[model samples]
Target: MQKIRAVVFDAYGTLFDVYSVTARAEQLFPGKGEALALLWRERQIDYTRIRSMAAPDGAYYKPFWALTVDALRYAAERLQLLLDPALEAQLLKEYACLSAFPENLGALKRLRAAGLPLGILSNGNPQMLDISVKSAGMHGLFDHVLSVDAVRMYKTAPEAYALGPKAFGVPAGEILFVSSNGWDACGATWYGYTTFWINRAGHPAERLDVSPSGTGHDMNDLLEFVRTQGAAV
Candidate 1:
């Protein structure tokens, strides 16, 4: 609303398709691949949330890489799947190169063309974000990649969201925080950002008082929102 000077995105579900790991997973686990991916992701977020809430004083912190591996192992145990060391290594390797969404590049280019500083504020560690960004061929698109590891916290925590404003040198209201996760969108909004929710899966909104400034089905819609807003300014 204050004329967005920066567009900070959530990396995993928003830019990179976390589900892309399903290819190798399917090969490893056959018909159970989809289930494994879903459960693994669920556990990953659950672990982060638990850690963040359990230590409000920032006493407990684990890098997302560790949490991701732990989530995969837990998911395998829950599903009664055999995840040998070799198979586990392969799965983690595939995850590091998660594919970007089909429209991600074009939309990002459009935003860049509009002269908005683009950044990423994510739970991913620096190395993980670096690998994923390069692998997706989005090497130079971002002006900043702010990882929660810097603050030893996770999203939905105000400190994690504060990284964006700090990185971009802008107020939260001047940053358009875009996330595919409804809870993330809500969190960003509550953190004072003009948020966008990319509801790619058509999921229901989180039961939070905060609502996104805009909602879209994909990056294409995000591009249009940026374009329209840019024109209006």
Candidate 2:
């Protein structure tokens, strides 16, 4: 394999714990927190996929922040929870600064020290990505924080994956694309990027024909994978 020149990560479930909002959610909704968090995440991704499928050219694009709010409202309604404006605002605030995974900063620092360019290719809007990176204390770790909003399309779409190589100025094959979502890994693979699936939950792989070049559970494992790939991280 060509030496990995740049590492691009998916933001939500890979580096940041999207479910970290559950604590604030529990404080507000008591027993429905976990369910709401899970369902909300599901619906958020679903909406992105629906939008992309409905308009591959991004004719139906909505910013990720708006989709997130819509998904939360839908989840709450499905659970029969009363999500008034104030409560909804609180949840959205928490989501804006979701917690980083415990192992992320250390691993990213090591990669950066090795002179490897690191970046984020996420569905988040630029403002959302900036705030989350700052909130997680990961402000200077990445060389780029790319958003699909540029193309107005979400991931699993070729346009979204293309941003990484374009931003890094490298061929897709030389950029190591890491994502926690199995489907996302598959998408990156299909896009011709060397992919790693961070299966943090140990979930089964997607049935998609494409598979990631590697798999692991956390940033530490990602560091090790980088080493094995001939990157001196």
Candidate 3:
């Protein structure tokens, strides 16, 4: 136990449900909506990782917002669906307000009540985070919502993970980074944070050689893990 002083979360797929946009997407594209949404999300993350690796110096870095839009366009073209201006605007608006996970509020409240400082360190750009957090009614739960846009990089990149310790003003060892993405959990663990992997989809660990300090299926499991950690400390 590293005497955790702060809880830093990954916003997109951890606290918020990225698939929530599928409902609106379904309405617009009929039968292919769900496929589009899934592909778009996958492509969005792939773009971030590819760009981050290709532009380690940040000279060719693209904001998450731009990558998101590009991913959407690519998804549409792949599906052979017409992405007119109006439809694109509607889809983008839906993305701006992704629903928070049902467990997020209660888990965050429990962590806050336990005297831990909570923050969000996300790949989302500032406006995207602001809109999503506000829409999810989670704006007050976090003391800081850090965006990688400031560093011109994405997660799995050390510079992006550095935002957590910088925002909390604490050592990486004193912060617990929680994320639904296994790769991100491993990255945070490598960065020296006590990482918790929220394996909500029951996926296996990433092959990155690093492992999370804890693993759970959901936020309730995270709550219990934190409790046990605090007790041990």
Q: Highest TM-score: give the candidate number.
A: 2
Estimate, for each residue in 78-184, the C-alpha lDDT of model 1 and write its tens digit: 99999999999999999998889999998888888878899999999999999999998899999999999998999999999999999889999989999999999
Model 1 — TM-score against the truth? 0.96
Quote the positional error of residue 20 for candidate 2 in Å: 1.7
What is the C-alpha local distance difference test score of each model?
Answer: 0.91, 0.92, 0.90
Q: Candidate 2 or 3, higher TM-score?
A: 2
lDDT of 2 by residue, 27-115 (tens): 89899899998899899999999999999789999999999999999999999999999999999999998889988899889999998
For candidate 3, write residues 170-189 as lDDT tens digits: 99988999999998999999
For each candidate, what TM-score against the reference?
Answer: 0.96, 0.97, 0.95
Positional deviation of 73 in candidate 1, in angstroms?
A: 0.4
RMSD of each: 1.4, 1.0, 1.7
